[model samples]
Target: MSTIKARALVLEEPGTQPVLAEVDVLDPGPGEVRIKIAASGVCGTDGHAIEGTHPLARWPIVLGHEGAGVVESVGEGVTGIGVGDHVVCALAVPCGTCRQCRRGLAEHCNSAARRQAMSGVMADGDSRLRYGGERAYPFFGVGTLAEYSTVRREQVIPIDPALPLDEFCLAGCGVITGYGAVMNVARVRPGDSVVVLGAGGVGANVIQAARAAGASTIVAVDAIPEKLELARTFGATHVVEASADVAKEIAAIEPDGADAVFEVVGKPELLTLCLSLTRVGGACVMVGIPPVGSKITFDAFTLTANRRLLGCRGGAVVPARDIERLVSLYRGGTLNLAGLIGRRIGLDDVFGALDALGKSTFARSVVVF
Candidate 1:
């Protein structure tokens, strides 16, 4: 097979920082497509992998999952997508034959989870990337941190070419995860009261989704004053600084407590607080990913009230369907895609972007390729 030389951010091992380096990409095999990445969004999940907090991130892998690109070529057996198509690379590619997928729960495909635990290669057990001619794993099968990527056919969702690729790239992960949590997982209805903790990338999207859902009262809680301000622009009806009295403050807005509480900060304490802030028969949705093996506890009495604590995976998204829906929302002006982008950066600035995640005032930093 012919080789394509490209630059990529490679995580040589766990506990070490990722570095920009040269790599060789192989052409797409059967049922795959090669993408010329246009933009990639820096996500908290990437930070977790760099910090060695994520359990499924294999070492010697390329970093990045939320990305957008144009299809460069298609391999044998690939249908529906073709060369020159604009697409978003989905991190979670469902194996249609898996038990979860067979049952219509493709978002939680067990085969995908199992694959994530192994080396970051395709199902064929071959590496699409190589460093110095040695096999290298590409994170989540679509390492968009690079100029080019090879991904399974199912992983690429075709999108409108008119949309700005740099901004729309967020739909691959952060946008979909947050928006789906409201529209799919929690199913926030009109007039519902929603409280979201953490006003960052995902939280900002959640605020907008709630507004689109016609939520009457949307409260955003975060320690950063700037993030809270950004949340307001995304349609937060109320903003509360995260503190010891946060639950009490939310209760004041919705005396019966919020209809749904979303914990985007993956802390055990915050998870518990989410449940407490939820009204009787309300749902506490967990959107943030906590460290593996972390434990959370709550009072049994709270459960008796019919308050539910639920975990959401990628917002239970079926990427192909949801990406198109979110793009439509963006076009209709119901969703603010441009507002979510704090800055446009380059591939070399990825590490700096990850470092500035919580400290920076921006909701998301996109690497414009």
Candidate 2:
């Protein structure tokens, strides 16, 4: 294939909007590879970056994290990956040399964090995008919004060539976030009861993961009827439409409340409700990113009853390992990744797709290249 210029949606300012612009992407450098993006999924975090709400972002940046593509070129020192290899981009690129990585916490690798966030050129770091002799930062380090990206070799994980790119693109973020939460973070046991609040893309995976973990009762709660319907397909044995009586409905099923309640909505009231729905000694995991300064208040007595409140980041996942496992589950027909893809659009239609996602509960819209 001939070298081609790529278009990327980049944020010019904080709290504004992103605009599509042409950019120059370099060939891979040492330990790097250039990927021809086949599909990119719009994630909630991308929305946050667009709104300039993410604490980890810098302006005049390219924002996109969920990406899947084919390897186009590999830099020196790269191995095991070759041109035409189908792969999914991972957000956390771990440097095994970091202190945290050595402790078996590669997700928290300080070196990787510095490198990925600093890789953006306009943001006072290395970068792959250039405009009129100026640099542009790639959000979350991958900048999958573009048609091509040169990223760290460790950031790409090969997937089954048989899996369609459009559908599995979501495995990069939402799918793995929820699925990993249940399988890795919670380690949910068989016969356990799970209450997942918010049946969005991530929430649905939580339901399916719980089912795969052999949870007996998977309760899905969402205000949208369509999402509740989707929850059933993913393994929710019981669905509760959100209302004032939601707690009552949930309590009727599990009189002592559920063993685990996941608050995926990120709203204060919803989180409080999730806390109320957890049985004594049960765990309540918060997976959503709430607005700045958002906090929840509850009675000390209730919290003292051995009720655990936990926060899960990146689904408490190590993407390289967990994503492969998830892909295996998908291949085995255990994880419903294809079903999570709500719609598919071309790059030219990405703006409209993003608008629709904000206005409606589009589980995920894949931008097929």
Winner by lDDT: 1
Off by over 4 Å in 1: 112-119
Instruction: Estimate every model's Cα lDDT from 0 to 1.
Output: 0.87, 0.81
lDDT of 1 by residue, 207-242 (tens): 999999999999999998999999999999999997
lDDT of 2: 0.81
Q: Write the per-residue lDDT of candidate 2 for residues 169-196, one digit (tens) a residue.
A: 8888888889877886767899999999
TM-scores of all candidate predictions against the true structure? 0.97, 0.93
Candidate 2 runs further than 4 Å off: 1-4, 108-124
RMSD of 2: 2.3
Per-candidate clashes, comma-separated: 0, 1
